[model samples]
Target: MTETLAETTPHSDEPIPAYPMPRASGCPFDPPPAAQALHDELPVAKVRMWDGSTPWLVTRYGDGRALLADPRVSSQSTLPGFPHPNAGFRENAERRRSFIAMDDPEHARIRRMVTAPFAIKRVEALRPSIQKITDELIDGMLAGPNSADLVSALALPLPSLVICTLLGVPYEDHEFFQEKSSLMINRYSSAEDMIGASDALTDYLDELIGVKLAEPADDMLSELATRVGSGELTRREAASMGVLLLIAGHETTANMIALGTVALLENPDQLAVLRETDDPKVVAKAVEELLRYLTIVHNGRGRVALEDIEVGDATIRAGDGIIIYTGTGNRDPELFPEPDRLDIGRDARRHMAFGFGVHQCLGQPLARVELQVVYGTLYRRIPTLRLATGAGQLPYKHDGLVYGVYELPVTWDA
Candidate 1:
């Protein structure tokens, strides 16, 4: 590893750019210009984190994929130098420890218990149910008014409904969980707020599992309750898993749907590809392209090094923290030509929108299917859906751990 001592280098005494440098004025759909600059200029160098720690920021596409899969790198949040997603998560790392924060063996053990529900085949089987849910939501939207906020009408509720049915959680309680989930997902949320939300959801899930224990249902939560009964999992553990699934199951995909819709509306040339097509293959291609173009998980994936590893021109040492900017990596020109352009016709299955290792999104299959349904049906069904407000006026979730729009005001001709 040839170490360089540039002004932005992590090891140098010179000034270093902050981990989440601000996004440029006009490019809301892209990563922060400063961070994306590192993708090409200093792909494997350190950057100052919020806590004043310097963690290696892996920005290049190849480097990010290599490090994420590297055995010497670990995802355990309990580790001292681990780069947590936010201050709240950092403060409560120990208490919030779930399989996602653990490395291999243990991670594999706990993750497998819930894998059956998200398996590709099982997820595919739910297409009809998902399609039905999507159609019903669109029906409600079309019948109600000429204009509606797409986030509340379609994006947020669709996944919430689907996940609720799968997890045996009542859709009537979505507001409670949605409010709690929002607090937890906001990157700048106070430690107390995040902790409070986590505790509330955990308690709620615990009680729900108790019901499943007594009156078993044919849902994922019932399976978890059975595990608790068999002494395979603790009641608390089951509840924690429930919290993760419920939050992750909706939040991430919801953003993609709303954000993707906004991006498509802004790019009429791209929107035409979807509105004019009934082919599932065409819709699936569009989903991948949108996933890559938007790349909603823009904060970057964090990990800690377990041992010394040489990357590009830098040697990440043991105990050092790492943050892989996968969202920017998806825009790597080397991997995808004209990467910045959203080309639905291009084969984009190789994009790292979901990520590239063991911790890649577990609900990716379900998310893809949902997006495919929405992209295939929504525009074609209405054939006139358009943004009611200017894109610049919409509030984007730049402060949250996820990247999305708060409200997507859209209308269609009746």
Candidate 2:
């Protein structure tokens, strides 16, 4: 069952195939025969990258998990002397230190501070507010004319509101800060634009942090500030986490809400099943399936070989960089049977969509709750939800690392 890259094929002079076009590029979600071919014949092969350099893409489920859990591998984007895709985007790599980009003792200490607050129990306590927010968004969707952009009307706003509530951000100022955050995440934007947005977001967070220090509320930001004041966390650490919560809380979920609706609309039978069920457990299962089906964050986790290590017959020498393609690993046939299908109860709990090991997504609990509320409410509230564009004409992200639709148009009877 377990196979290594050397067992299949070794490095070759023949040119590696161009990166496979994502299903988000208007094809079906099934992994192309070409991709699966690579998975089988060369579980780990160097592929031509967008930047004209080659990066090893790990496709087999076991190899991906092994690499993800390996201590020699790191999440740091700025590992000195290693080839990185982000080399152009970052200047003085030491300047940026995202928690996701940190390793070991530092990552452990900072993560411990926020773990309890993001735990399922703490997130469940916000159910009433989340439900109320969902209802309000549904009301707005109904109030609009029959045809509306579901993304702008609901998907985008719902996550923003929920994150604001969690962080105690004033709802009134969300629009301004959310725009700044969006600009930072949209990779298509120029390097200058990204840097500007990052500065603007940091400035905005500093302002909010100042306010929280003065009038501490029962919010995460307030709690972070309290920790900082008590010398538990540095001001820089507190600021970084605040920005991370805001960005991660919204960007990924916004895509899920937008793209998941597209998937359900494509399969009306599944939509019917979900619409008829009001049970939280059922909705939760459906959310997992949708996450698997959408596979929005196509980009993989980045790692480097600190020393020579043998992986599946291939010895990656010290300083070689690798990327564990999580999206590919989640859909490996050996892991999920009929990997392309969207079966809500397919028992896909093993999926790495939220990733695995110590670096698993910290905000996963909140994301799950948001999806359940949004999807459960959408179908029940709008029994006639359908795509406004023709099936073949729906717009989707073609080349982004995180694949999602540019717009999700939908119509429903009021």
Model 1 lDDT tens row, 308-327:
99998898999999999888
**299, model 1: CA deviation in Å?**
0.8
Go through the candidates in order and give the clash count of each. Answer: 0, 0
Q: How far is candidate 2 from the true structure (C-alpha RMSD, Å)?
A: 4.0
> What lDDT, from 0 to 1, does candidate 1 have?
0.89
Q: Against the unseen true structure, what C-alpha lDDT does each candidate score?
A: 0.89, 0.76
Candidate 1: list runs displaced more than 4 Å.
1-14
What TM-score would every model get versus the actual structure?
0.96, 0.91
User: By TM-score, how accurate is candidate 1?
Assistant: 0.96
Candidate No. with top lDDT: 1
Per-residue alpha-carbon lDDT of model 2 for 1-414, expressed as tens digits? 336544655457468765533453346455445566667788787766555656667777788888788888777767753334443345424655667777887788888887887889889987778889989888877887898898888888888888888888877887777777766655455667767777677667767887899999988889888988899877776877788888888878988998888888888888998999989889999999888766776656667778777778677767776767666677777768888778887777788888776798898999999999988889988999999987567666544456677688899876
